[model samples]
Target chain A: MKGMSIIVKKVAQLISGLIFLYGIYIITHGHLTPGGGFAGGAIIAGAYILNILAFGSDAMNLKNKEQGSSLSESLAIFIVLMLAVFALFIGSKIFFANYLPKGQLGEIISAGAIPLYNIFIGIEVAAAIITIFLALVIFKEEVKK
Target chain B: MNSLIPLFVIVPLATSFLIMILGKFINGFQKTITPLVLLFLTVLSFYCLLNNHSNSYTYAIGGWEPIDNIPIAIYFVMDGFSLILLCIISLIGFLASVYSISYIAKFTSENNFYSLLCLMITGMSGVVLSGDLFNLFVFLEISVISSYALVAFGTEKEELEASFKYQVLGGIASFIILFAIGLIYWRTKTLNIADISALFHSHETSTFDLFIQILLISGFGLKAAMMPFHAWLPDAHSSAPSPISAMLSGVLIKAVGIYVIIRLFFTMFIVSEEISLLITTLGTISMVIGVLLAIGQWDIKRLLAYHSISQMGYVVLSIGIGLVLLARGVKPTVATLAIAGGLFHMVNHAVFKGLLFLNAGAIEHRINTRNLKEMGGLSKHMPVTSGTSFIASMAISGIPPFNGFFSKLIIIIAAVQAKFYLVAFLAVFVSVITLASFLKFQRYAFYNKSEHRSTSKIKEVPFPMLFSMIVMGILCLAFSLLAFPGIREQILGPAIDVLTNPNQYVQTIIGI
Candidate 1:
């Protein structure tokens, strides 16, 4: 139930917000950048994981609380599915049709639906990683007890 | 018509996520929604199958048109062969879902089980429908991964152990398959199955092609649980929940393993006599070995699981017979018969094996034991389960008037006519052994007098479970109609044609 030293805790809190912001940067510019959803999502998950390690298990509960990580994970993927299904409803009904207009190449929103997909997938991946991490933590705790 | 293909994968996938989200707020949402979605899929698949009987239909995901006669799109093909598999996936999935409604009540995480089941369906649909090799691999993992979780749903000692073993073997299979696909992509510079076949033909046969072929056979062989690579079947199938065992036995192996082998070998690769011979040899060995293993099992579900391996052998062997004959370019009619019988047996196995497992589940539900020695004289208490299981056992044993007999009959006739007298004899011999084993199962589980446990207090499983078993029971008899010439031609004919003439597939897909 205890956490690490004060130095680690102070450093983790300092960098966590910066890491979260960087993850957003990577996800938002996924159309023009190398990192996209999966990589960016991993980095964001790393931020949360760092905070959890520095703070204790009780600092944040990640599964099945009020709109917890598990629920958010499910909700995120459901929205992504709806977006894909949205493509079918709009056009001659293609399942993954990029129905929206393309702004321009190399822009933040160039690819019509790719950025949107990347953002949602990033959320899903991030939430999913934390959820799995928290589950292992709880299991380890229960085993110790 | 082709456009509807994506819905098969999409609807189940969406339903899976939808279940987890709404299951938190709504009571019984997972139970109600899962069966209805699968039912909708079953109707959709049959409708599409009848509408486009002869020709293959292709859909380009994202509507990406072919670039200068080269396919740049992620393609999905729905021909007669895949359509048959689609029907199997949805039909079995629906029945399993309905059965799970009652059966899964004991499990605390009911929502997780249903979600995983739907995801499994989505993956199988994508596997059969996809026209790209890499895409199929992705879908294969999706389904198998879901199965790994489902098998471990109980989280008990045996269940965890079985899932671990299944995962290790399954991981190796996926690695081998992905390596093969990587080779295909490297060699042909395309992932489209139709284009790969077309490109393969334009070039002379090389050792590289043979290497990839061997890799694919071994890789998918592991997935199919062929003779040599079948250690995972009994443990994984027996340890899992009954509905999952039914799905894994009935649909998962066929759609992900045998169906892919049939599709890739028939349509995607030029027929090689030696490879086909190897396949047939594997089939025969698995047939004898699987049944031999089954006869000694005390656990009813484990016994049924071993029988799955044996029955799959019939399918692989017959398909191999067709492949060898086609490569030899002689007696096309006989090869057609062999394949027709194979495909027919696959369908019959799905129905009857699924029913048998459900019966085993029902028995286990009433009495807390799967060991046949622990059970006795339950025929009076659970008439529906015992009666249906009798039909299932008789059908699987190839008795007359059941669908299994007809399919096995066709396979043996074709084998004999093709001058493979040994195959014909072994096949018949195996059927007799299967009969003995099932009879033993019936005797001990239902008719035998047991001194150990009193059976007076045991009640039948609830309605939902019985309903699924009864429907599958009727299907065991009803599918015998498929053995008739008129109906056989209508149902099995197109599937046979697809395998016989591979060029039609490439032509249809590539617009040659």
Candidate 2:
């Protein structure tokens, strides 16, 4: 449960922000690029996991963060589901219809609702992985106790 | 009409997430919202049934309709078969949720339980409604994962062990299914069931197709817990909470396992005589062996779990016979009868088996025991549980005037008409053995004097549990009216029609 060597901790702190930024970049470019929500979310989770590895459990208060992450994950999934349901109400189209206007091709804001869906999935997947990681950490701590 | 298809999956999925988010802060929100969502789904499914009226339709999600006669979007197909499955899932889901309102009180983290339950429902509804094979796999994972968590919810040593076994087997089953899906996609260049069916129909059958079929049967057979692939079911069903056990035995296996097998074999792939015989042989083995195993069990829930395999065997056997007759080009009417028999038995099993598990839960809730040897004279103190359990027991045993008898009779008559005389004999024989086992259940649990002296504090379960059991008990008798021609035409006829004509299914979707 102790923090890693001071050198390792300093290095992790210096690089974790870049990892977070890269994850955001992948999520935003999801509609036009190869790495979408799942890959990007995993990268985001990895950054947080790195922070935990360097700073120790007490530094992040992982138990409380896990609760927050789980709630956010649920909220993200809700947003995704609501987007689909919103289709049914707005137009004569079927469920998950691309009701939003197609802005353009090969752009961040294009492809109707695809980017929006990707962002929601990104949030959900990121939060879910972090929660799982924190839960395992908490479980191990409890067992040690 | 096409627009309504998504609600089956959406309502449960949305409610699940909502419950998880809000349930922590809002005391008792999980209990209230879970039942309300399921009840709404029940009404919606019945609405779907009434409106469908022998018609089949497909909804293209994201409005990406077919291009140049090839489907490019994910499709949700609602036909007689899916609609029937939808009704079963929703009705049982509603009843189980109601039962859980009281039953789940003993467990902490009620929010987690409700969330997982809703997710399971969403998975099942999605499985039945999906027109794409890959989408089916996704939903199947959703349900299976939640169920694994549910099975281990109690966190007892036995529950954890059972859940571990379930997860390993379930994982392998998913892998096999995914491998087979890869083969299918490799061959047909499509994931849509209707598109794949059309493609297969135009070309002559290949040995690779047969290979894929074998993989599919084994994979789905594992999920269905057929005789050869039934190791996880007894442990998983018995170790879980009673309401969960009811859901697993009543609808989950039928929804994800048997239902998928029936849909794929009948509608997606070409049914051949050899395949039909293979399926029938498996069904018969499960039927005989499952009951044989049940008779020796002391744990009431474990005994009922074994019978789930046996009753599911009855369903698969009848349907297999129907397939054989259809494949052999003989006795079309008799084949239709066989299919109808199977479908009716399926619905009947869901009702009675669900009631039985709920009964088991009620007894356990009151007495804190699952061993029949420890329970006795419960008919005096808990009249509702005892009476409802009796009705369920009689119904499952194929006693006359109950729903089970009519469906069993139809199956036997159909078997005889189809000239499978041995099958008819075995069907009747299994019914008898089933009766004997239930009599044992009745005697030990309700009739005999208590072997232990701690029976002083036993009482009836709470009102919600009692209410659900009573409703299911009434349905046990009510569903028997399906034996009539007028009723059969409305409820089971279209489903049989859809199964009998695979070409019709393809055409309905592709409009060719």
Candidate 3:
């Protein structure tokens, strides 16, 4: 059982990583495309769920999951907020404007502030979803046991 | 200031998940950790509120800018109104967490309870802070989905039934709201509220516009538990845990229903005379019928739940009167007063009604029953519960020196000034009946000498629960200070301004 679980864990981890990378792609291209932070983050969380299932109830530590996800989520949201404040400080009136120099459109680094905001949202959503499921997994085991 | 916007949603969202994870690894961890985290977030949010005086802060997704005066990205805006509502959400959330410390001890899964609680708060916070309409819908879904699950947490027959009913109504509301969003997007090809408002301002009137308005009213009205859409409130509010009930009754409906309605109608869309009159009619009908229903209830929570509908009716009626005056271009100051009264009453309800629910929870906690007939002479064994309930009861009944009285006074004064004599009379009449009904509660549940006293032994609830009740009772008194001079201008004035002149909100957020 342990050997099979390890094999399953390795495969799931590989798949989850691929999905996470895909989420990053989606978030970065959010402005020019259909997908953004929420959709990508949900996908990333799906990866975390898969990993936990493979490893069983004790696979992930709830405390670490909670601490890590909250910090990341807070940081991501804060980053987006700080950017808006920066615009105010610099003489821009409205929030979420493109503060950066607009590069050539359709490039990997284009859309100015759009890519950056997507990155932050992607991080927050992914972490929040993971924390939610991990908390549920851990709590259910404790209740059952 | 803009940098702080995401923290409003992120802090609670992350903390809730964290508590769930911690609960999995450690025994009894959630009971302590969840409340502590919530308290920390509440303090942080209050700090933010104090610093955020009169500026509207907006956060854009991916830092996207409009290419040709067209918004192509999601944005979040927080102004005086959203900030005030945010403070209320955090304040009530913190107290509910504190109350839950002991209240949830009887429940089987502390972790799940905390998780749903956090999710609900996250959704509410997100809704308040969201700048885009679609984003609001997403957060709205987050909050409602968790709330549906929370309502049925007990898994009893009635609970499941209530959850099912709530979900059906909730789903329909969501469907209508989505279709409204689709219509607005279909017309303007934009989902941003400011952009939509700007679009509608330049465009000619159409039937599609009216259709969208009706759809939104129904959608948010159902969530707000307005009279016509209030079928699910009595069951949904009474069936949840006390703290959760406090949340649903005190904060959830306001955030999702009335708050959204106010934000959309006042800020995002124009309020026509027809719409304003419709709102007044809904408010008056709900006020009379909700109280009439409550007078006959034996279930303690159900009675409070029905009152939630009636009290909310007071809020809608007051605000609707303000809207009617605004539409007619009549005495602007008196209309502003009416709006302020309604908004003040919203805040007061959060405090006193929330306290009343917690008090009911304490009674139910000690005796294991919510049937008013099954409870008698509780004051002898639980002085703190009895005292606090008396304070909350007095406050809700509009007695002097409590927060509820000032708001009700303002509403009555506003009603009379506007020449709505019948409304003024009915408002006063309802206040009296509310007093009588609460007196019934005090007589039967707390003070009346009864047979249960001789046979069964009861005691004051554990410290955490009592501590929450006492704090809420104190707020019921302290918040009345808003009726005084400085605080009203500093806090309430800005909120009233945001609603009265919706253009100021768009300009401020767009950095005019």
User: Per-chain TM-score of chain B, candidate 2?
Assistant: 0.99
Model 2, A1-145: lDDT tens digits are 9889899999999899999999999999998989988999999999999999898997777778989999999999899889888888887556888888888787678998888998999999999999999999999999999
Which residue pairs show backbone clashes in model 1? Answer: none
Q: What class would a CAPRI assessor give candidate 1's docking?
A: high
lDDT of 2 by residue, B309-424 (tens): 99999999999999999889999999999999999999999999999999999999988899999999999999999999999999999997999999999999999999899989
Clashing pairs in 3: A81-B3, A82-B3, A93-B511, A113-B62, A113-B63, A114-B62, A117-B62, A135-B20, A135-B21, A138-B24
> 1 or 3, which is superior by lDDT?
1
Interface RMSD list for the candidates: 0.9, 1.1, 6.8
lDDT of 1 by residue, B307-388 (tens): 9999999999999999999999999999999999999999999999999999999999989899999998999999999999
Worst 10-residue lDDT window, candidate 3 chain B: B503-512
Error of 1 at B8 (Å): 0.4
TM-score of chain B of 1: 0.99
Model 2 has a clash total of: 0
Ranking by lDDT: 1, 2, 3
lDDT (Cα, tens digit) per residue for candidate 3, span B228-325? 89999999999998899999999999999999988888777766889888888889888988999999999999999999999999999999899999
Lowest-lDDT window of 10 residues in candidate 2 chain B? Answer: B48-57
Worst 10 residues of 2 chain A by lDDT: A88-97
lDDT of 2 at B27: 93
